[model samples]
Target: MDDELVLDPYPSKIPSLMDPSTSIGFLQPQEINLADQCFPRPQCDFFNPFRTMDGSCNNLQYPTWGQANTASTRIIQANYSDGYAQPRKSVSGHELPSARKIRTAILQDVDKSSPKINLFVMQYSQIVTHDTEFTILKELGSNGPLKCCNKDGSTPEIIPKECLQIKISDDNNSHSKHRCLSVPRALDTSDRGCNIKPVRQMNGVSSFIDASILYGSDHETSRSIRTFKNGKLRRQLGPNGKSYLPNVKKATELCNVTYDSTVCYVTGDPRVNIQPDMAVVTILLMRLHNYLCDELRSLNPKWDDERIYQEARRLLIAMHQHITYNELVPVILGRDFARENYLLPLTKGFDDSYDQYLNPTTTTSFTAAAFRSLHSSIRGFIELVNEARKITSKIRLSDFFFKPDIIQKQDNYDSFTRGLLTQKAQEVDQYFTEEISELAVRIPDRHQHIDLISVDLERGRDYGEPSYNKFRQLCGLSEAKTFDNLIDQMDKKDIDALSKIYEHVDDVDYYVAGLLEKSKPGSMLGHTFQCVVGEMFFRLKYGDRFYYEFGHQIGSFKLGQLNEIRKTTLGLIVCITSDIYSVQRNMFEIPSSRNPLVPCNSIPKLNLSAWKEE
Candidate 1:
């Protein structure tokens, strides 16, 4: 309750804000620009050497954090009859100890065939995933482009894109593979379907209403907490898998237009619901912060724990304050506590002398540190209000969270720089230990990196290794290497050939399609990504044990959700009364063999005159 308790510093021997161990690099693309472009000013500097905010501002007097002595300064002295430049002081010898640097080197330089060999070292399997075209169905399949060309000149013949198929190889180690998505465009009623129409068809054109809402996180209706007798941590259960997709529910219940023409996102169950995906999103955000802090501390060796912690805190608070304050938002969201009120008490601790300062009361009933700490704990309770809004859009801060009418004035850019938010992801490589695929849907060809790096685990077998596990191994991730030899032949035709491997594949393949396919509109892939986000947070905030448990629960939930999606996929197919060529049946619930997503030359721009030149 006192100011003394909050303002008191650690003992003299303990490190202050001047230590080198703390720094949080702005990681996301949106966050990076906030730090680099919109912000960065002298006032935000954490360890101000001049110790005065009055008009006395001098770059020379400011304590240099990391930058070299590049500025020139002169302080007038009446006693100095002659002017002379001070000799350069070397700052390098105090080498940083706690920090570690990634080699910044790449795998292309590593010898894969050595004792530290990998899958690509030995060649393996190929896969062929063909996409269908949309025109093949319009006008009774009369006109459309379906072939493809060898854009890279890899083949002796340049296959016409309209009739072409793709092939990938793994002869030598490395990615050595490529695939392209066939884009599709719908025809205007003004053109193709303008034939003799049924009397009820208005303007000789047929239009259907789409029933999918913008992706919203599962809006939970229940928040019941259950306790366990043995003291094991309790976990939260998400919404029922079936109700997650709303369109699917609409189709079966509504009856008006041609039964199947209306596209919907229905699941079978009536009791299902949706809510904000907090578990994953929050966890990942924290993990990134921890990783950044830990990396900086490793730079200072002689630095004791006290010094390392304080310096890191100083560095983090400075950067965090600068970016968060100068960012593009209202001022209330970017408060930095340590800099303003708490002072001498924060500096009191050193060896045993500072112990008494930890909780001494101040006259004001609360110290500055105590005030800020209390504010944070109370704010954490209101975090869900923000999480609820994130489900709709990554940057829809105003809609869900509190938004004051006050504008972010032109000058404010110098204040709230750290609040920028975007989904731009960093690649999984040396700089980062891992990149989480925490989206609700698996984007098509999302596994290209894994496929690019995978190779044969054994010799001479046309058999190959699993694409998923191979990808993990290649990235140096800890995963059990199953299907030791899923890659059989390195022939460029591997994936294409795998597409036809009906006997060789299993439920897991479709399940994988379930995971990745969720990214496809109507497929609802964001749910899966939410799971990834949850696991990321568990690892970052709580550590590996929490991540493992959370991941297992998420995996189980996804498996259940996929089963519902599979039913929906079939429902959509059955509801289709028309093929690409014509309405095969007037009834809505007709049988179908064609896949809804097949490209069949559906991609148009690939053959565009402008694109052809490139």
Candidate 2:
């Protein structure tokens, strides 16, 4: 059967080419055709004072620059092994080391927790990542993951072209007896209309830091979630009487739901139920949106639903950007990096840094390699703590994959919220817990498991990302000419491990080498990753015309409104939205003598009076 002809829910721009082994030829200049959807054709609404749901018209000049469903922007050109759209190969014309083997060799099982920061840092990082980039995967006819391995643990006689199954060995303890990990290639704009362009992956979500995670990315999705009457998003009351995200019936297909009453949630982002931490954060933002609407409506009783909703949405997006730059970016990239690059939000005045010429689209390096290095910080289990900061119960993180039944239980929402704010995340390093390294997501009815460490290694190659040394040079660091010269950026032990597995210094994958390097001062990432991530954030701010801090843009907030947004923080957002009574002043960091837990009322909130209209 031609699986490409199958009805895929999220269809790709080009149909799958039938032959897997044939090298695709480039199209002649005259033969190249660009489909209408391939390029942005936004009908920008100037003077709207609001961003469109699909991210259109954000850049008035380049209507689709940061729009959803557009091709990702690349800092460095893709280096496909076939000079077109194939996965990258090793420098010696041989296959790279097996992903599972790389995992076992470099990443050890360790439970090292960060001393200064809490798991909220890791959890919120996921929220920011989901907001900025979401690479869509090729799907089977049933809209499910492609199954490449047969029941007998053998490759299919006629494998589908979409299947890039990770080859595994039986001796691998994590898999037990499974021999393959099914991994479908991410969908891209390759071979579409014979465009003669390099295969560039598509981002399912908008590249802008708009609240697409709360409201959907497209108009249809955004409308589906709204009530249309009171400017509130649809929500179902939890067993505890507090509002929660609306439920979907496709729990059996999308989630590992073990209960009958509770099903998977319907959120702006489809990956919401991927983990409980992500679920809690998504719910918080959803609640924040509705909360802002209620406050805005109370202040402006004559305002209609559309006016109230847009005003609330505008505030929510501003708060989201504020927390991301002020709290999240500083922690991950370091405060000094944030200041030096003008990545921080201004406290009082407008930032005159909007650049229409710059493309704010998520880069291949940031989405595929540099940003993914933070996976090392994820802990093995999701801890539930009481208001008193006492550990009541712990759930193995893997067991709850796509299963959010536990979160809907009595008091579990607040408990999990507190846990994230109080518990320390795994220290950012090369090590990973067994939960992620061994028992990651498993293929249905198959004994195989997806090792995320392995998946990250393979994803970089699949994206045709340049090797570590090249990226090092791109970041202005010394590129190693030989394996021995890697000592400057990498520890002696890390260089020794790379020398054993890789054929040459140039063959080291970007994600692997970046994670292995020592952390720069006061930053969670090493030099190359810091530089790449630093540059990525710089673009996300200046390249964005509707940045909350900017003054002269079509959607720019008033000076008073912008200043109130500056007062927003992760602590205040959590305090007002959820049932948590008190939290640390800086929820991103562990509660210390300087940054101690304070009553919710003590935390400064956006005085909605700034938004009151005459």
Candidate 3:
């Protein structure tokens, strides 16, 4: 009765908690093999056929293992020496696993921590597609500068103190990227980037913000590409469309891989192009979503809210430091040298990468559907934030979730949205609603309105190639607010430079909303959206690749208490974690025993008979 072969709906196969020896455990990978079901004929209908696949794990543990599956007990020198036969009882009738299995488990655990990843690749034979582990903080001290270099971990002649960090623990996400190990702001923890425990204790990091801001610390950022010729259009973009000051590239150095424009490739410095704050934010949101997704599921049965918030906030802070320093600055400063002109690749992705990479399978139909749905959800999220600000006079309503919202609602909006948002905010700063405004008018049809709500509620983040070209334009010189003392003095008969600029931003929100609204729905788009969210999560959780695989493999930093349950219509997963994310000072719990999400529920199936338990 292999669990995979059983024909039942979640039978009670887990071991009893009452057993003191239950101890902690993790999953290991194994071989996969299965047959495809057909209707008494070689050529089966293509619409929906039973495609069976096998996924195996090495641990051979029984709770997850089924009846008749043999358990391989480790023959330990200490166990044998402990006197179970100390007195030299008659030759035992017991049988032990072959030496090969014993050696494999011991060696694998030695090379890695815990056991194995608990996931299965669809249609593929792999049992684990991701490597989830722990990170120990290696602080750079409060006043030290942040920096990034080649994979060798080389120190730069000059260091940028800002950084973006991303990290992931046990994965609860269906997509690999959602498990993160990255952050966007400066942080309290540092890592040598491996599972090998550093001697220092794990000092929990805060979410991205002014360190003082959380304690209430400081937060901020830069770069250059080209100059705008007349009628060439000043490319800077922002709220109300104003030009910023000319790009102030750090004059001393050539920009390194500045992610500005096409020409940056030939001439601009790679270091000069700074990574976008949005990218950093994207990673932050992704990291927490990735890192905690699984652990929370493990403890999904009865974990508290405080534990979730505490874990999310800490991961966010670490990422802030990594993103700001490593990727953001280098991306912004390269194109202009002065940090001014040019377009980026984000938009061209539709033409360049979207067709070739993203929509290779389904083309426009499905991706557009999911994209539009996500677009609506994001817009609605923005509207809700604005509504809160209008009512409370600041963008502090989110804080109420952490601070005052509980007082207002008693139980608060702690459902999937808040949970997802809180997890997202943990990775990025609370920057989700920086520039969103909806039309004051709403169609009075309640049914239509409810449909809108459903669309908004279910929408996930954009996974289509990002529109970075627009982002660069918005952040460049053209978008900065103008300020000159002499302008007022000459204003009596002077031409208004400000009015000329004002027209550009008059409908920024409305224009974007229309585009978002037009995006429709489909399964492919939904999967891509899931992938994008996963990618962003990975980036945020592991903002710096300097450490490699984000250091998840070498840890005793196993999953501790977890709490996850976000089977939202949006296909979003919100997870909460604890000390287990970084410092491994605890035990592992039963996975999915508590998670309401049914295994393989996310991936649609044409044939349920294969997965069904009889």
- Which predicted model would earn the best lDDT? 2
Order of all candidates by TM-score, from best down to worst? 2, 3, 1
Alpha carbon lDDT of each predicted model? 0.18, 0.78, 0.19
Q: State the lDDT of candidate 3 residue by residue for 1-614, as single tens digits.
A: 32223232211111111122321121111200000010011332233211100101101121111001111111011111123211111123232221122112211111111121110101000000111101121235674323232222333444333332122224322122222211112121123222211111111211112111111111111012222111011122222332211232332122222233211110111211121211111222433433442344244424344343333333333333333222222121221111111111111111111111110011111121212322221211211111121212122221211111121122222221222221111011011221111111111110110112211211101111111112212211112133232132124111143223223222111112222111111111111222222222222222221111122322111121100110111112112211111110100111222422322233231221221122
Could you tally the backbone clashes for each prediction? 110, 0, 125
Model 1, span 308-349: residue lDDT tens: 333322322222222221221011111122122111111111
| Lowest lDDT block of 10, candidate 2 | 9-18
lDDT agreement of model 3 with the native: 0.19
Tens digits of per-residue lDDT, candidate 2, 550-583, equal 9877778889888788888888888888878888
TM-score of model 3 vs. true structure: 0.19
| Model 1 alpha-carbon drift over 4 Å, by segment | 1-310, 313-515, 519-529, 544-614
Tell me the lDDT of candidate 1: 0.18
